[model samples]
Target: MKDLKDLTAIKLKAYTPVKSIRTSWNVPISDFARLTHNPIRAIVEGLKIVPNPDKQLIALSIGDPTTFGNLKPAPEVVEAVRRVIEDGSSNGYGPSNGFLEAREAVAEYVAHQGAVTPNDVILCSGCSCSLDLCISALAGAGQNILVPKPGFSIYRTLAEGFGVECRYYDLMPEQNWEVDLSQLETLIDGNTAALIITNPSNPCGSVFSKSHLKAIINIAEKHFLPIIADEIYEHFVFPGYEFHSVSSLSEKVPVLSCGGLTKRFLVPGWRMGWIIIHDRDNHFRDVRKGLANLSARILGANTMVQGALPDILRNTPTAFYDDLVSTLYRHAEIAYKSIKQIRGLRPIMPGGAMYMMIGIEIERYPEYETDLDFVQALIAEQSVFCLPGQCFEYPNYMRIVLTVPEEMITEACKRLTEFCEKHYKMDDRIILQQQNGLLARMNQY
Candidate 1:
């Protein structure tokens, strides 16, 4: 028996040394598919195998406020949900567009942005789902939508999945992340369906100025395209900046404004969001009908949440909102200052939103090859997680969410500082090479 066991162990070791499972299997795969799942989550999952002994893992990757379980939703909002459950009438499927009251509630909430009515509103599970409906309805196969670079990945993912081309336009980081209107105009053609822009821009975190917004609207009008406004981060701007509803600003081109209770209200779990059509000239008659058709297929946002929408929109105290904005402002400043202090990282101080895009001086860290590699190494060495810029179609940069607790953010920054100090190098040649490489990538993109 002992001799047999030894022989078995020898055979197992020999088998391990040889490559196993090399069979060709025909599996169905879609050419249009892209990993649209949160790339931030993907990074965190990949780093789970790396052992970290010195520091506890501090994840600032996800933008979910509820993840920490500290930031509470409004008392009024909670009461509304409680009342919804007690009433028990909201359990059934809502209207295909949304509950009438909920649609009317959303329409009134953003009524400041021109005239909006219940007929102009369509609800969905979340802002993301709302986007999916909008883009899918607007663009068919072989059509294209112009998206902002260093923006959310979902735009590309959703468009590609729907067999629509993803056209990217650059945002000037030096100019408070405003759109390069010239570049934007050049990307427009007959097949272009719409222009999508995120105010209080994601990844960059720079809010569009009123002038910038007008310029974008003008460009959209000139090219005869509608606007898809991702204003989920609306009203989260800091003291110096103000949130402008694109629908409120545009008079000619129709604006499909998307927003939810996720960011400002801190009720992401409710999964309630809406799209309000602002067609001053009724340019989106067909588009609105298409949106209705799309909404019918998916039903609508949570009926119970829809029941609470009235209170969530109207009754949440103004003080709660002030406090929320104050909290975000403080954290953004802290993150900005911390990244500024770090030797090899250059961050564009965000004026809005809960993110700051920090640029990695690749030449300063020769040990790492790319931003993705740098982020993976940071996770392995310090157990700190942040999203790489490549996930947003840019490289050598990282997007950090400032929604976490102050102490955790500070600790993560400390770990990042130490990581950079440990891997710091001085090489000008590497910078030129990286610049050339980035140029090549941009050209290809």
Candidate 2:
């Protein structure tokens, strides 16, 4: 009749509910572990658990560009790495903030935004890691952080795991995914520590205009919250639009801008990214110290990549970027036009990044229950893969990457179109009744 509390911490393993007890030294998983796990990876794994030999799945799920296997790093960057291997200095430990040379290079690259120097840059494994560091440093247990509703889920994942709550602010899809200022102001309270924004956003893919960027800055300044600008897609804007850094517009508020070599350099595996401290007024002195303390525990980015970064930043030809961005522009056009051609699916033409957010009309396609059901059924039938809006915490929508080669994208769209055609329905009532009944009928080839 003795309770489990009577046992010591070490002996408490015997109180485990399962058949087996910890006979030796054992550890239990933390509640935070489940929250911290990447939902994207889990979804991908869930979809792949069962192997269908007949159906060929075309992946547009993961955002890593290198998965295409066609895009390669600049020759100079490869050569620089080769040289680093020969020299063997970068093979050893370097500064925690980053190699001074690498920081200087990132400083020079981002200097166009504002006055920047090597002292302002802190490098990490990648933009994701930099974001993790920033979010963890800024907010502690029980505090709240404002994030975009359809934003990258990692912010929420990490925030929740760290015991910080995440509050979502709506982005107006009708107005090209701009933040709803009124909704944003309403979400703020004393517990809110920082506001996270992704420019050239993921999932939403809409780049903020200079005016909008200034408005965001003004709001942050008014509320005294530092901005975590996720600028990983910096300079990835298409023909008509330009990427503007929020930090460039003002000096009153602090900006911890995170970016990486992943998208722009076309080498995500390089794992090199940095945080640029844009505190022109020295307002973030304590924040910078917190970042320094956290970064010190992790050391820095890949030294070989760090060694190559300077050459990669300075020597990469202008034509290289021009061609890459232009190609992305064309792909975005193809995706936008193709999505428009399809009934019941409305797509917002992206200004930058490589994604387009497509709004799904569930009433039009009553066969599927939600965006997740739509994509799952699409993959099951047509073998076309896309992340549902649920992955980004915004349901009734789906996100597709347009940066894949044009022919591949065209063909994927063709398959997506076929999938829609296969399940097309004029009447929602019949489709509703047929959810289980007609689903099999539609799946029949």
Candidate 3:
């Protein structure tokens, strides 16, 4: 044997690279872990990566309202945008807070909810951007924010990226997906900065009742945390349910009410959304300043969307909104009926929005180990592409978009039932093993 030091040197030299790269970049990506788990993007990419050629893909993957033929913006709304472009009104830079008229329109719109005014509004690109701004403005790194579970993933994503802690409270499915107030209270602490509420919720489509909204306001008031109400689906109520804005519920708690022209007006690509600082007694000046600073950093939302907003708000016919709601109600009815007949799937009838969640009896499917496995198998065999419940941070369920054509809903449900029949058998041991494995994975995380 060689000398001990010489032997160590020889071992190190054996692993030399063919080439070397040099750089001064020392900071690691702070948000890399959170960014990698964007389910929508991951699912889209997964579809592209699959080598199989015979996949019958019916994408109920994302919540884009325009895919089904709903109302496009009115002709007058389009003309307003065209006029702004032709006149070069939006060709140059605009105020960081947004155009005065656009902000005024947002203010007036929020005013209709009860107590908000134009002075409270700040326009941003969309609700996503508004949420980011609000999170950044109000909370710094290592602080905590409360979010609803089986809810919008963006709130968790944004909070994590900013190094803010995200604490989740349950939206109990048994109780029509209402926010669990006791859970909310337990999740809040001294470092908590804000609480988020999504009216006409995205995944569940459950609208909060007036009594529930008031109770939420009381919770916020007791905690001294500002409320971030995402109302993008505000007016998309079904036949029997009515939409309530959080600003309408209280004059006591400070609310950062966010809404967009995307879902209700059917113009998502337009990219115009607003954040209104609803402080009835002038208590949120610091929060307002923080928002202003954030807006200043990013500049304003799109000028073209901003320019047309006044007309979009004022001139869009009431008939258009009424018809849109009626169409959605009909689609919801069709989808609900279809889902009800399917074996091993349970759907709570949605009251608002264009999506519904269906609980999957994992025990019913012997081959499925989790909701993701069930969804993947469904896509491979039946060509149906519903979102797995785990994608929305809820396991043992899947979400279906009701925006598909009425005929497609019937066909999709039929395929789903057949798929379940083909794969599932009433085998107790297999299900217990799968559940044990799933529970182990959950506990590990």
TM-score of each: 0.87, 0.89, 0.86
Off by over 4 Å in 2: 1-26, 47-55, 428-445
Error of 3 at 124 (Å): 0.4
Instruction: Assess each prediction's global lDDT (C-alpha) against the native.
Output: 0.85, 0.85, 0.82
Ranking by TM-score: 2, 1, 3
After superposing candidate 3, which stretches have Cα over 4 Å from the reference?
1-56, 68-71, 427-445
Candidate 1 lDDT, tens digit per residue, 159-191? 877778889999987787888889989999899
What order do candidates take by lDDT, descending?
1, 2, 3
Runs off by more than 4 Å, candidate 1: 1-51, 428-445
Local accuracy of candidate 2 as per-residue lDDT tens digits, 1-445 = 2565556654766665555767998886897885677767766666633323576667777687777766666687788788888988789788899999999999999987799999999999988899989998899988999999788989887888888999999998999999999999998999999999899899888999999988888899899999999999988898778888888887699889999888988888878888999987788889889999999887777888898888889988888788888888898888888879997889999889988899998777888888878888887777778888888889999898866667878888898888787777767666687686778787895
Structure candidate 3, residue pairs in collision: none
The CA lDDT at 311 in model 2 is: 84
- Write down the TM-score for model 2: 0.89
Q: What is the C-alpha RMSD of each candidate to the true structure, in Å?
A: 13.9, 8.3, 12.1
For candidate 1, what is the TM-score? 0.87
